[model samples]
Target: MTPAAVNDADIHNKLRKELAQSRVLLVDRHPEARNFLRMTLSAVGITSVRNAGTAHEALRQARNARFDVILADYLLDHGRDGQQLFEELRQQQLIPLASVFMIVTGERAYRRVVSVAELAPDDYLIKPFTADQLQSRLLRAMYKKKHFAEIYGHLEDDAFVDALAALESLLARSSEFALDGLRLKGEILNALGRYDEASEVYREVLAARVAPWARMGLALALRGRGELAEALVEAQALTEDFPEYLAAYDLTADLHERTGDLTAAQETLLAASGRSPDNATRQRQVGHLAVRNKDLAVAEKAFGKALDRLRGSSLRQLDDYTNLARVRIDKGDIAGARSVAADLRREFRGGKGSEAAESADVAELAALVVDSLAAGRTGDAEAAKNALNAALARHDSLANRRSTAVSQHLAVDLAHACLAQGEEARAQALLRRAAAEHHDDEGMIDRIRGVFARAGKEHLGEAMLTQVSDEIVDLNNKGVLAARSGDLDAAISMLSQAAERVANVQFLVNAAKAIFTKMNRDGWDEALAERAQGYVRRAQAKDAASPRVVSARELCQRVAKKYGVQLESAAKWKKGTDSEAE
Candidate 1:
């Protein structure tokens, strides 16, 4: 039963450490396999591991325990297969988001196992394989799990900075990863906004073998660096080699969209979605594009399919719900949109459980904006602001996921509301602020471009949209310098002007925050106050507790009420409203 050449102690230590630090569950019908697993784990420096012999016992173990890893046999002697037992465990939510899942099966069972993509285990070990494979797999899992744990946790906690830092550390340390580690590290780096580093990683990886993911990653890096045509060419080449690799299609679509080729983008995304209809994310993207193009039927179908196939992660599910609600509004189903919005709100909140509380805050805030928008009740913007502010307050005062999202959302939402209320200049100015602050959000940039186009300022939006990455860092530095001087009005004016000059919401948000901070200390002027309220309203829509929005909520409410106007939620919007949102 011993794995040849693998230190039994190392396995045991790993199992115990993981269990103690997070969650892990073990299931085996054979007493010897159980003993080997426990002893091997114990020898590896792990001190804790739970075991069960029967399917029922395994399920019982899963229900009572919060485990980070699950090791199950393909064949459980209790009539039920190991796969069935683990599937049941997952459905019950015993495994936290960070759990490392692995399945042990004899090669003989490979064909018998159903092709349940949704139930795909994170790691798999064939029976009779050497202990080295198991140990290697476990080590990689633990290290990667630890690295990614914070991202999942931060996304859950709405602590964007913590999440980003975790990714950065992962990238810095990935130099030591032998092939396997390097690939995951590159992905983490890409997710963390270090596209240049990720591109280098991918280049090195491709030097040996052209992995689909690496190729995709490189395409992304190139695209972000403004090498879109080349990126598309590379992606197209990769797609030919790996016809079924759906992500390549997405990358290609991104290239087309960036180059102002919506027709090509739509066709490419549609092709990818058609081939992988079961992937909710793909379907959602297609729906998003179709809706943006005013192809209401296609958008409705795509979004509806996305919602039905929403068996992925929590974040993916919420995004689908938000988009689905938007599609419903396009269909003029106000009641349906509201109902979906309500459902989306609940899903976004997730649960009140300790493990879910932080993410729940994010979802609740997101839902408020989405719901308010769908209902056409500008009145709900106040609640959206309140929710965002409250959610942000749950974390630290500065630089987190809730703060970033809330800040960006607030700027964008407020701009839309202002535009809706016949305040084009104010809305355009707020949008400019958002662009400066949230450069990574391509979708937001696209939406704001429509706004500029509607306002006959298409050239400005195009200029900003095309040079997002370069502007983000520069915009921040210049905005701060403008505020540091005695020229508070000039600072606000310059920042607002730069924001309106382009389509980057993050940049706009960054400038808006700077001016808002300076103005609070100086004195609020009527014009600055109008623009400031738009930014505050946007932040409130994302997280009512954004540092600036929370401080400015009361003033914004008073201003909005005085104007007899309400800011619509981001998630809800009628066709007429959406048309003007550009």
Candidate 2:
């Protein structure tokens, strides 16, 4: 036999050995289909199997047990499909990472939807496939997940360097997994903020083949490098080439927004969500872009659909309800707003003392405040103001135990309420507190500015912001002068002191630069390295997309390399934006 044929035979035998002891779940509404899957799996010695005749039942069984493989049919009862179920399972994180999911569809058209989803199954099989075909596809998925399990574990733990090391070891040890390892390596490099390295890997992959994933990765790398126009061209080309790919649409939308084209961004997400209606996250994103574009009708429709998708799933969030309510208010549908607000309060009434419940209280009161003002009911508006004050007082009493992040959110909500009730002084105080706590968040600053601008308090808000900015700039100038005068210690001290007083991105970046420059001049200090890393990470957390922040982080990484020390990348940050209401 030829050497290639011998290797193929060996691989087939290994797959059979692995499948013999696997645990499986079969989800098909038809009894005949379930029987076929059962018989086929048992023929391969996969005896530990279960069956579910509906999507609801399948979800329950899948959550109850950690099956190694799941074969789900495309069509289920009650207008639901296997793809919807799969999306929900992933959205709610109900399935284990190692579990292999495969879709079984009778319709050839099903391929189009699966090809585009952000969370697709491990594999898929068409109807009329023989037991042999099933075994081959299932075995391939199982083996891939098994081989990369360690790398996946490292990624889950946010250890990007360790994950890259594991991927590198796998690539060197075997050529069979080279493509998979390279794909993972690209992802890890992007996560570590090493866009140049990621771009190189993607370029190498595309040199060998015209791969869509590689093309998308290259687009992201371009964006990370601040080449927005190039990234936009690449993203637009990718969307045209692969119209069904959901992620390409997302990339296109982001690029559109970055280029000040909110209308295009809104249209892109709206079209993508129309194709994949079961994706709640995409629906929420659509609502956000719509609101940003001032399309309240579209925002309401999108949020309503998102709320429907979140029904009977563990993926529901308080924002889903609040967003719908706020959009309703924006659309002048006060009754709808009240209904949604009531539903939100009822859902969390059981957990009154919990942080989430308190946040819900703030949201509900904020909605009521807006509703009252819209109806021209001054008395009701004043009542909401009192209630809001009571809630804020209670939250502040427990502020010592909760995070300042929670307080920042509460403060914003309260500030909005204050403005709606015409309490300018209270609103100004809350705005100042929010600014002091979250000064670096440009999105929040813009959102607060919008709120005041609507209330004819724009001058007041801008005055306060200008004062804060002036103080910060003065401090930064002093630190810069110190560094230029050969007093690195004084520069670092001043910058660090400013950062401690108010967590802003510019201050953090300044502190990081001084600390790293000092480390480069003097021999490395582990403590100093740690302190500098902390500054860069804080800056990244506050503003990862800013070119200035990205450049500062890259410089720190270069310094760490020169000193032969490791500098960990910051974990991804999730900030609250104005669209959180959507």
**TM-scores for all candidates?**
0.48, 0.72
**Which candidate should be chosen as best, given lDDT against the real structure?**
2
- Weakest lDDT window of 10 consecutive positions for candidate 1: 573-582
Encode model 2's per-residue lDDT on 1-582: one tens digit a residue: 999999878977887887888788888889998998899887777888999997767766765666788889877765466766775565344565577889888656465655443236776688888877888898888778878999876654335566788888888888976766787788767756688999999999989977777888899989988999999899889878777666788899888888889799888888777666756677887887787767889989988988876653444566677678767766767778778766766665555456666555555554444444434333465566566666556555545554424435445656776677676787787787677646665445766786687678888889998887777779889999998897999999998898777667778888888988898898788888888778877776655555556556666766777778765543222211111111
State candidate 2's TM-score: 0.72
Can you give the lDDT of residue 380 in candidate 1?
50
**Could you give candidate 1's per-residue lDDT for residues 1-582 as a string of tens digits?**
466436656755665455445444678888999888776655555556888886556655654555667788877762445654554444333455467777788776654443331233566677776556666787676765665665565433333345556656766675544554566556546544567887998999889974666777788778767788889999888666665555678778878877877777888888877655654556767876786677878888887877765433332444556566656755777677667657755665546665466545545544544544544443455554454344334323222643323345444544543454345666666676666555565666777876576557788667766665576667656766777866666667767776556434444455556555665565555666567656644454443323333234433333434455453322121111111000
